[model samples]
Target: MNFLLHCCPVHHVMVLLFTTMVAMEFGQGCTQITTCVPGQPMINCSVVTHDSNSDPPIQITSYVLENIPPNSVIYCLNDSAFFDTPGTVTYAASSDFTINDAINAVLLIRSPNREADDQITGRVTAFDTPDQSEANLQVIIIDVNEFPPEFIAPDVLQHSLRFTEGERPTNSLVGRIQTSDVDIEDSESTVSFRIKGNGGDEFNVTRMTVGPISFSNLLYTYDSPLDRERIAFYQLTIVAVDSISPVMTSNPSLQVNITIDDINDNAPQFMGDHMFFIPEGLEEGVFVGNVSASDPDAGENATITYSIASSTFDREFTIDSTSGILRTSSFYKDLRFADNMRRLTVEVMAEDNGVVPLNNRSVFTVVVQRPVRFTNNIYMFELVENNNPLVTVGNVSASSPDLVSFYYHIESPGSDKFTIDRNTGKITVQESLDRETSPMEMFIIAAVYSNHSDLSSTAIVRIIVIDVNDNSP
Candidate 1:
């Protein structure tokens, strides 16, 4: 009977060892723990073991893994002695992971996100028939530089800004740029900004903190003066980059378009000499002269209009507002009747078309002149015969209303007997004369003319020789 008992215990031990070997070969069983040998009877046990292919804790980088299949195994759990006795092993985990009942494995149902936390702690429970085992399934999510800096404020990706030329002061804030990064905090903190393009020389960027939360902002400021006449438009690109090694820049960079507006900063200026001359007795609508002005501004600021501001002969002259042509008005008359030489002072104004108009004034001197004429047409002069040479005789005088000097000459025959002064109309005897040789009453014609005019006057002069009778018969 004792031999029988020993044989029966050996058989039971062999059967238990066979079941454990089969469960281990299949790799879908509990932990194989030998409590007895060939001479001892087996004790029923429930044990859970980790598969060689799976580790207790799983590790991966955030945002690196994508599209993991449902029920994807991250960890495997097995019972070593399930073949010897009827026992089932079930697996469970925290919210970060799920259990696959068919394979008794832990699955990565939810991906690890470093944004939530760097480390995730989850309990993986393995439940056997009568006992359960719990293991910490720690998921270490590594941080990675994934996304580049992105612009958020200045909500529109592209911007257009306008300012009047010379209106904005240097270092004035023109715009604000705000950016965000979806990466980890360290990456977001390392974001910086810069400007690129041909127009960058006129602008600058500065970092600033705003709001109670100290939000980061990039301020776009004017660095140089803007002139609409010089440069009217500017194009720039705004780029954002992180300070991390192998820096990442923003994709599809932001654009900044700047436009310069015009202002009436330049006043109209008169051009050329402002002196003019016109003759008297000019008909109405006679073109006197033209006055012109120029401005170095654009658009309406440069448009010019002309007018006669003040004049000595105000009602006698008229000026075209658009063409700047000055003309005689209906009130114009012969100025020579009033004054032989008349000079008029005219004040001309040139104004620009602007919101607040600007103007310039200039003075023009206009002179009026008349034809030269004499005051007398006839004169009488008396001289005695047998007078000594160079003897003075009566003078024949003439004048011009134009205030011009005259030259006189004798135009009649027998004039050589007497000489006349060119500057003054004084008659003098050239030689002694007797009454028989020359006529008793001599009539001579004298002419007076001016170098300034072709018009002249003639006068008749009679010289009656006295009968001195100094002739030898």
Candidate 2:
């Protein structure tokens, strides 16, 4: 029995030694370790040591791909595992690393976390080559603190905000402040916001927390009514704090300046008393004195538009909307027959273009003086015989600014071939003219007001009747 036990123990030892040799051959073929960034694709097999003298966190570290064997295919073992990558990242496996390609490929690693799996495990297998072997790959992932939270659209740094006074409602959204932490998305890399300055009570700011993979945004709202006259602007400081405990103190802060926009609270006012003098029979489109006023508001709120609110004469004058220039649009008429002081009153109003408009009205008394005698006296015309005889020949235009209405008549010795209208002074052919009878005709046309005898003017109208083929020769 003792001899049998010895033989059995020897056989068992042989079996154990054979198993150990096979395991060593499989796992220990070539256990090569190389460091690389997480999202980065190429595996640098070169032996490189960190330099404590230079800046520690550098973007790229050199890798010697020439040491890797030929006909070798690289395999990433963590295909099914999840890992953190900064920004949008992609991976590629290549046999030969060129100088340009290696530099570009190194940037794709994104923000790799050193605390996590800094080095990835992979396998390099060779085919159809002597010393064909399977080797272990160790890739070190490099961590870079390159990303900081940034303000999104409506960059608070570049833009200024405005709110109308007494018009904005409470809790109204004034502006939105947003920030993003792009690199190494994790609990330690999260960002938060807070407002940390004066005027905090005037406005309310709310922080909206986002997920680990997203960003943070803040909503700023007006909490009360603002009086621009009392306080026109507000200055506040905002700070962005990261989730990193000690690092939060080193984050960024922003100073915001908000302006309160003005509203139209005061009406336009006339400067002086109302009465002025203008002579009767003044020409149309004549510039009257300008009406001046002032406004307490700013920008367009101070702009005034002048209008003729009421006038004894209908549509007799026009006022400029911008320049406040008042001009006559029609001939001036005397009102002395009514037993008054020959005076005219017009109501002028001024309005401001503001968020809410304000207006003021003022009365203007214009004293009418005696008009000068009419000076325009002569008018001439020519008519074609074949033209529609009922159509008007030309109007006998005369200067009589003081007369509201006038009568026109041909004086004695005037030919009955043409007649003048009593009101419009328009002359028409009473009958078809025969140039053969009177080739040239002369008439004295008189324009006089029926009510006022002094307002009268006469013109010598010479008519040339051209001969046409109307007569059968």
Candidate 3:
């Protein structure tokens, strides 16, 4: 075995001074032993500081073996700690010394624990036949923050939230966003927050300073006003990024769901004008028309109940609660059936059921009139000449408030020449007549009996007869 110093000029001087001190302290008791052991002249190499969290089998530094003997071997001796530990640091080897035995052999050191920063010592030894020599190696572990920040809770927020429809106070805390980083000693492990996904701009996350600190109290606030009728819910993502260089690496993200609570903020309105014209004498409980309205709210806040809030004849009219159907009430029979037109004004109310109920009102105008024989007051027809006996010359139509039967007859110049059907008010020629002797004029009276008496209406007909040449006298 041979003792040799292999290093740069700087470390070479430190190794000599350190060796002299150790030798003087221990005197001849530390003999120049020609054997591989723990306390030996450490060929001072460079000060090696490696990054923690590096992969296994990381290189610390290398040493060189000078002037080796033939058929001799060089290897690492067991250190008290990491280097020779069974699983921590195994498989240590120096560049093959046998192949180039005459020249200096480079020593290469490696360990499998790449993420550890514990300061430990390592050793390497050389052997020649029965002789051996050993050297001490110095290694320093530097901590590095490589892992990103993560949410302390689930990737999705566990708490569901809700807010009213309005602007929130400035800097008002809506909720807390919690996070953590595993790197304790790293200054760059501080976590900052950002909101993303849809409606991200509606909220603001608290800012954090750059340094090692807990990010568990990151509170979020509402930045913009809310309208439940326009937008009901929001789905968003919260991202936590470390203050370290290159913000994207290992950044954590999570989803948060929020809903806007409803409010009865809108009023009801009628679809059109409320005026209506109905014939007189309609039966009780018959539907007249509908009054409709709507609300801009959601759920129970928009559900509306209706009522006939006021009317000139309250006892004669009614409205449905759910459907808003206007109808004649049971007391409609109590009203007088008069010959003149009557007018009634009604007000309908629509109300919503919410945390705070709201209401609206609308006016309805109803006109009632007696039944008439026809929409038009006057009716006339020209008679064609030489018609068959049963030929219908014309028809007289009528309208009524209620379904009622009518009778027909020829009033003025009642003659056997023409007749009217009692059921249909159709006038037909009873017999063929000569234009020379017939009066050429006639009238029809359409009548319906009320209280066993005839209530009549009238129409006219003129028979214009043409002479045939074959009938010349």
TM-scores for candidates 1 onward, in order? 0.43, 0.31, 0.48
Clashes of 1: 6
What is candidate 2's TM-score against the reference?
A: 0.31
What are the lDDT scores of the predictions, listed in order?
0.61, 0.52, 0.54
Backbone clashes for every candidate come to 6, 3, 2
Question: Which parts of model 2 have CA positions greater than 4 angstroms off?
Answer: 1-138, 142-173, 179-262, 266-357, 361-473
lDDT of 2 by residue, 281-330 (tens): 56777766677777777778888988889987756667887787777776
Candidate 3 stretches greater than 4 Å from native: 1-115, 118-148, 154-157, 162-171, 182-190, 208-227, 242-252, 263-277, 296-300, 330-343, 367-473
In candidate 1, which residue pairs get closer than 3 Å at backbone N, Cα or C atoms, i.e. clash?
Answer: 29-78, 29-79, 29-80, 30-79, 30-80, 31-80
**Rank order by lDDT, top first?**
1, 3, 2
Candidate 3: clashing residue pairs, number: 2
Stretches of candidate 1 exceeding 4 Å from the true structure: 1-146, 156-158, 162-171, 184-189, 196-199, 216-235, 258-265, 272-283, 286-290, 295-303, 311-316, 328-346, 353-356, 364-473
Clashing pairs in 3: 57-111, 57-112
Error of 1 at 192 (Å): 2.5
Model 3 misses residue 188 by how many Å?
8.3
Give me the candidate number with maximum TM-score: 3
Residue 22 lDDT (model 1): 26
How far off is model 3, as Cα RMSD? 16.3
